[model samples]
Every structure is written in structure tokens, then in C-alpha cells.
Target: MTRMSKSESRHPVRKFFLFALIAGAVVAVRNAVSDKGGSYDPNEANER
Candidate 1:
């Protein structure tokens, strides 16, 4: 019973890491797209 409870407690920690990993991936993709200059020129903005 003790071991079962310990293992059950680890489940939430595993889920938290999984969620963090997914969120990090989403942020990375968003940054990459925004930096790619698809619609705006970053150099022009920097010159100002």
C-alpha cells in the first residue's frame, strides 16, 4: 500500500513534465515563425 501511494504520487509529476515539454515546443515553434520575417522586415525595424 505504501509503495502504491508513492507510485501514484509520481504520476502527477510525470504529467507536469509532459505538459511543460509540450508547452516549450509550442513556444519554440511560435518564436521560429515570428523570427522568420514572413510578413515584416526585422532589419527595417531595428534601424529605427
Candidate 2:
């Protein structure tokens, strides 16, 4: 069996933090979109 190096051992922690950051960003964007009457369409020209 191969042994894990010191750097490799921190992969899970790094992934967890990365996932948390992404999740927080998504939540923030979702909240902003929802609070804006939920009518923000990216493909509509009249949205401006």
C-alpha cells in the first residue's frame, strides 16, 4: 500500500473549505436573486 504524504493528507480539509466557499457564494447569489422579485433573467434584453 502507498503511504500518504503530508500534503496529500490535507486534501480533504482543503476540499471541505473549497466546497464551503462555493456553497456560500451560491447561497448569497440565490438570496440576492430571490430578493429581487425573482425576475432577473440573463437572456432577456428588457431586464435592464
Q: Which candidate is the best by lDDT?
A: 1
RMSD of 1: 5.7
Q: What TM-score do all the candidates reach, one by one?
A: 0.56, 0.59
Question: Where in model 2 is the C-alpha error above 4 Å?
Answer: 1-6, 39-48
lDDT of each: 0.76, 0.73
lDDT of 2 by residue, 24-46 (tens): 99989977885675665554525
lDDT of 1 by residue, 1-48 (tens): 999889868789887888999999988886676676443557654765
Leading candidate by TM-score: 2
Angstrom error of the Cα, residue 21, model 2: value is: 0.1
- Which pairs of residues have clashing backbones in candidate 1? none
